[model samples]
Target: MPRIIVAEIDSAEQRAVAVDVWRAANAARRRTATEARIRRIQEKLDTAELALLAHYGPRPAGMLVAETYHVDGVPLPGYGHLSMVFVDPAVWGSHVGTEMIRDLQSRGWEGLSVWTRTDNRRAQRLYERTGFTDTSNRSTLRDGEEIMQLAWSLSET
Candidate 1:
C-alpha cells in the first residue's frame, strides 16, 4: 500500500519529488516539448489550492492537485476543481489514482471537476468509472490542445 501525504507547497523537497512523479507519470504522452511541459507542471503545482503526494514505501509514486477557483465563463458553486492527478506508469494499474479520488471525495466536496485532454480516452474512462460525467464543456490550451471537463456530484456518490 502507498502512503498518501498532503504536500507542503512551499517546501523545495516536496516540490522536487512532485515534479519527478509528474514527469514519470506523463512520460509517454509528453514525447516532445519537454521544457514547456515542465514549466506548465511547475506553474500548476505552485498555484494549486491543494496538493497531495503518494509514496510507495520510500518512492514518490503519484500526485494530485486541487483548485477551488471556477473556470472562466463557467459558473460552479460549491465545487472544487481537480487540477491534476498523475500516477507513475510503473504503477498504472495499482489503483493509486482511484484511491486519491476517493480521498478527495471523502473530504466532503459538494462537487468536483477535472479537465482532461480531449484524446485521453483512458483518463475519461477512469473518471467515468469513478462517477464523473462529461459536462460538454471544452477549453483550449495556449498550445491549441483541446480539453474536456468532467464533473462528479457528491450527492450522487
Candidate 2:
C-alpha cells in the first residue's frame, strides 16, 4: 500500500525535493523557471506558506505548496491557494494527486483553487472529481500559455 505524508517542508533537503517535484509537474507544459525564481518562490513558502509532501513509502512522490491570502478586499479564512502541485511521472496513476487534495481539504482548507492549462484534460478531470468547478477566470503565464482557473468552496453546504 502507498502512504501519504504531509510534512511542513523546512530543511534544505525537503526544499530540494520540492524543486524536483516542481520540475516534474511542469515538464512539457511550461518553461522551467530559473534557479533564482525557484529560490524566490521557495522563500515565499518558507515565510508564510504550508508545504505538503505525499510520500510513497520513504520517497517523496508528490508535493503541494499552499498559502492563504486575501482576494478582492475579502478576507477569506483558511483559503488555501495551491501555487504548485507535482506528482512524479513514475507515480502518476498511484492517486497521489487526489490524496493530496482530499487530505488538505480534510485538514481544514475551507476554499481551494488551482489553475491548469486548457490542454491538460487529465488534470482537469482530477480537479473536477475533487469538487472544483470551472470558472470564467483565465490567466496567462510568463511563457504565453493560457491557463484556466478552477475553484472549490466548502461554504456551499
Candidate 3:
C-alpha cells in the first residue's frame, strides 16, 4: 500500500529532500546547477510564501511550491505552481507521483498551475491525471529551452 503525508517543507525531516529535489531537477534537465544554486533555492524555500512536502511513509518523496501571486492582473485564491515533484527515479511507476498530487489536492488548493517541457510527455501525463489541463501556452526556461505551460483548477463538483 502507498502512503502519503502533507507537511510543511520547513520540517526538519524535509529539509534535505527539498535540496535533493533541486539537484534532481537540475540533473534531469542536464543543467550544471552548482552548490551556489542549491543554496539559493534553499533560501527561497526558507522564505517560500508556501511550501509543502509529499511523503511516502517516513521518506520525503516529493514537494510543491506556491509563489502565491496574481495572474493577468486578477486576484485569485491560493495558486500553487507545482515544482520539483521528483520521485527517486529508482522506483519509477510506483505511483509516487500520483500519491504526491493527491496529497497536494487534499491541502484544499484551488487555482493551481504547473508548467512542463513540451518534450516531457511523462510529466504532462502525470499532470493530466491529476486534473491539470494544458492551456496550450508555451514559455522558455531560464536556459532558453521551450516549455509548455499547463494549468489546473479544483472543480466544485
Pick the TM-score winner: 2
**In model 2, where is the ten-residue run with the lowest total lDDT?**
23-32
Error of 3 at 131 (Å): 0.7
What CA RMSD would candidate 1 show? 2.7
Writing each residue's lDDT as its tens digit, candidate 1 over 27-120 gives 7676563788789988888776778777665767778888774759685667888988888787777667777777777777899999999999
Best candidate (score: lDDT):
1
Per-residue lDDT of model 2, residues 81-117, tens digit only = 8777778776887888888888777868788988888
Q: How close is candidate 1 to the true structure, as a TM-score?
A: 0.82
Which residue runs does candidate 2 get wrong by more than 4 Å? 28-30
Clash pairs for candidate 3:
none
For candidate 2, the C-alpha RMSD (Å) to the true structure equals 2.3
Provide the lowest-lDDT 10-residue window in model 1.
1-10
The best-first sequence of candidates by TM-score reads 2, 1, 3
Which scores better on lDDT, 1 or 2? 1
**If both were scored by TM-score, which would come out higher, candidate 1 or candidate 2?**
2
RMSD of 3: 2.6
How accurate locally is residue 55 in candidate 1, as Cα lDDT from 0 to 100? 69
